[model samples]
Target: MANTTVPEVFATETPEATVEIDAGAGKHVEPMLWGLAPYQWVSISMLVLLLFAFFGAKVHKTIAGGLDGKIAAIKQQLDEAKQLRAEAEALRKEYADKIAGAEKDAEAMLENAQHEADAILEKAEADSKAMVERRKRMAEDKIAAAEREAVEDVRNRAALAATSASRKLIGEKHDAEADKALADKVIAGI
Candidate 1:
């Protein structure tokens, strides 16, 4: 029979001492404190800091008050914007009504102008007709007067010719015998 001895795999002299084992790779160990891992300790530290800030500094109250002030200011601005929008809408409606009224006034003016133009045209036509009629009457009167004057002149000339012819006949044919015979005839008739 051969004699052999076995080596202790795990041995520690203190509770705080870290254990090491040889694997095929290099040593890899995570540090610890109070039975917690490093990551756990960091998380606990962050939580304590938050608690201290909330209780000792009243940080939550200050944050809440600041947020409330900001919200109130935003609400006031919103209300002012709403009031301005309402005023703008009212102004737009007023202008629209004015434009409608202006359109109506323009239409009325056009109608009146058209009526006046028509009336003027009618008056002008009547005046022209009256003027033509008056001119025609005057021309007719002038023609009638000219005709009467010509007739009177012809009659006067005819009377003069007849008197001259009668005088010539009396001078040529009338002698002492004609004179005596006319006197005897006239005395017998009387």
Candidate 2:
């Protein structure tokens, strides 16, 4: 009996089916790998290196821009500080000048006051001297008047005594007409 199961052989073959293509097939396409291998891995590593290089250059440029900006900001602050210092110095000078001017004004005022005081004192002294001189002249004039009055009184008394002596000697009434005539004759002769 022919081995009823016809001798079977082990095989590992895949049957192929023909696919129809039309003239209008849009485009031929490159096949994609569904799995990774050593060659593909090398290619992936080169791509990754190129990407990292590009991104690293971009990061460096960004960092440089930020550093430049920071430097500019610091320089601006320094300039501002310098300007402020100059302004402060100018203000200080102005204040000093004002203080000096005030001091000079005060000194001038003091000098003017001193001059006024001196003038006042001089006037007072002159007034006092003038008053003293006026008082002395008045006193001298009063003394002269009083002396003249005393001399007149003494002369009158002497004349009365002489007239009485003449009356006693003559033993007569001294008439007014005779006395007048005698006084006039004596005065004219002297």
Q: Give the TM-scores of the predictions, in the order they appear.
A: 0.47, 0.45
lDDT of 2 by residue, 60-121 (tens): 99999999999999999999999999999999999999999999999999999999999999
Scored by Cα lDDT, where does model 1 land? 0.86
- Model 1, 46-143: lDDT tens digits are 99988897685677788888999999999999999999999999999999999999999999999999999999999999999999999999899899
Any residue pairs clashing in model 2, and if so which? none
Q: Write out the backbone clash pairs for model 1.
A: none
lDDT over C-alpha atoms for residue 184 of model 2: 100
* Poorest stretch of ten by lDDT in candidate 1: 10-19
Give the Cα error of residue 188 in candidate 2, in Å: 28
